[model samples]
Target: MANVSRQPICTLEPKMQNTIVIGVIIRSQNSKIIELARDRFNAGTRAVWNFTLRDSFNDFINATVWGTVEYVNKLFTTFTIGSVVEVINAKVTERKINDPNEVYVPSVTSPFTLTLNQHSSLIQMHNSPNTARYLKFLNMPTKDPGGATNLNHILNNSETLKNEYVDVLVAVTFVSQTREIVTRMGEMTKIREFEVGDDTTDQTVSLTLWESEWIRLADKWEPKQTILFLADVQVVFNEKAKKSILTIVRKTIITENPMLKETEELRFQFQRKPDIRSTSLYAVPNPNSITKQMMIIEITSRLNNASVLPSNDRMQLLVVVRAMVDDMNLDCDDPTLISYRCAKCKRLVSDEKESCMNLECPFGSGIKSPINITSINVLVNLKDDTGYLVGCRLRDAAAEEAFSCSADIMRSEFKIVSSTYTT
Candidate 1:
């Protein structure tokens, strides 16, 4: 590592050359191969990778790498998030702020963007003693969460906010499995759905993930554990659903688990509330507000709306269902009748396991003993005139209330009942 003249991101200017810069990669996007048309019948492919880097002084800027598919993709895959990277000879270009294409770029505090090419610019990991300071910037939100639009206001004034960009701070409630669908052009694309809620509202909002980079990053998001500060999310009105929905466009930049006063307050708010589904937060829902009774078909239609999961715990749809229980295994002598979950992290633990395996949990390390709680875990099916609802979880307090017995008592009675039935 030869000593080179380095400049902070704040002082970088357009057309500046021969100056090296170093920063931490706060965010990165997946590399994409763009098809370039050379002639009527000839075509070429180029790769592009975009990422954001932040300096120790908190100045942040967006950077892009462009070259052949192999060249750009290799650089993108080599650097890890939050790692310090040094760039040499990268072209500093003035950003086209008013251009229509700017809408697709992440909102950054910098006035210029850095363009790194395979021919001249070089990017590599730079080890430094100040690496800890740069990594701390990862937890800093790009925008203040306190200034974000309240969730209740968004819900109430959805129509007014349609197509408007807004900032939000929310907790992850549910992350859906990724799915692939064919677009109008017959191109296959990946998408993942997320439900997020905040202290201001009982309702949960949908945030869809379109890029493969984001979808892959979402794998580590745990419901009720992960917090997100999303900047420049577009609020679009869905005519069919007759509601305004928040969408993560290319312009949206997200900060995970932000270290701020507001973040601690929100976490405390969630801790004080009883663990209930998406219908309400901070307190149990009023029985009067849950009067929207729907048949199984209508309920299924709403769940399939691509906005949320029906049973998502962050915000639940509290509804009165007048249906018959088609199937239940209350008296079955099954070893899986009871569920063990870590008290600290709320993640399921196997019966043989003594602790939560989630490394993020406080007790996940073997040095500490994990506290596990046991609860009744059973699935039931309900049928109505319209359709059938299958695989509904009847667990925890709801399970005990429905069966009129504690999980331990139910287990004892289940074995006796099973033996009697067999005899």
Candidate 2:
């Protein structure tokens, strides 16, 4: 590749041919290959890779490559994130603000998008002393943190901000495993859910990564270690759960482990663990976030308050209760010991059904085989000198651990072992 004169991103114009631009790859999504129907009987496959490039001046633009699967895949794999690459002979096009697809593009200072064609555009690894200037863009946020919304404010006023977009600066608190599922369009995709929190509040909020690029990047993120500045993230409402959720739409731009002063402040806050009780059954890594011991009467009172209070208004807390099992079915062979629920809608479904039964669910209607998650839904009644807690459900890993049995255990042997313990 010739060291052609590099052009600044701010000066790029539509229809500009034989253009050379040099920048660092701040963000890049995994290349996607899809089958395209050209005619009634003919079909072909095409691959596209999308990434964001930022110049030393902090001016960034969205770039896309469209070509055969082999060409796009090679380009995507060859140029990893943070690589300073030089683009030659690429075409620049004016961005159509009114285009629906434009919403998916990252918000950049530039008003144009770069298009790299297989036959014309060439990408070469840039190696020069000037590369240091572009490296700083890797950790710089596109937006200022002064105007970003706090996680506390977003959660408190979620109803008012429904369907709106907001900027946030948060640190990763937890990362969940990725799950693969088929969408309503019959396309298979993967999603991973993770939780983040900021100094504004002790409450942590869960966010999901739908794109393969973000998902892959999140795999390396460490809990309480990685700080992020998210721009233009959509606030969506899940009616079934009766709460607001932050979703990573196409307009969302995530800056991982930003190097801003505000991010350092946030990191300092994480270094000093908060004094909060864990409200989860799973073991928390932090010893400071331990569960409190509560009497049965206190537990019942808290449950009553939670039942009447709005979901958004409810306070989160974790506690340990000391009580004797008043009622339980130790017979593991009982069919009621295990239950299935539609993963998408959280609705109960028969074990024999292949799809969710809730017609309103996206995976419900016309879905021949909806995805479902199995749970060990065993109900146990506990009693203490103060009061009795009835129908307390023990599910998932907790249930398996309590009974010393797993889902794969033989029914007869599980029943015999379960009978040994008197509840």
Model 2, residue 244: distance off in Å is 2.4
lDDT of model 2, residue 78: 87
lDDT of 1 by residue, 18-80 (tens): 778888887787788999879887479999998888885458888889899999978887886
Best by lDDT: 2
List candidate 2 segments past 4 Å from native: 1-3, 34-43, 274-367, 370-423
Give model 1's TM-score versus the native structure: 0.64
Q: Estimated TM-score per prediction?
A: 0.64, 0.67
Model 2 Cα shift for residue 122 (angstroms): 1.5
Clashes of 1: 6
**Cα deviation of 414, candidate 1, in Å:** 36
Candidate 2: Cα lDDT at 112: 90
lDDT of 1: 0.76
Clash pairs (backbone) in predicted model 1: 277-316, 278-314, 278-315, 278-316, 279-315, 279-316
Over 4 Å off in model 1, which ranges? 1-3, 39-43, 272-423
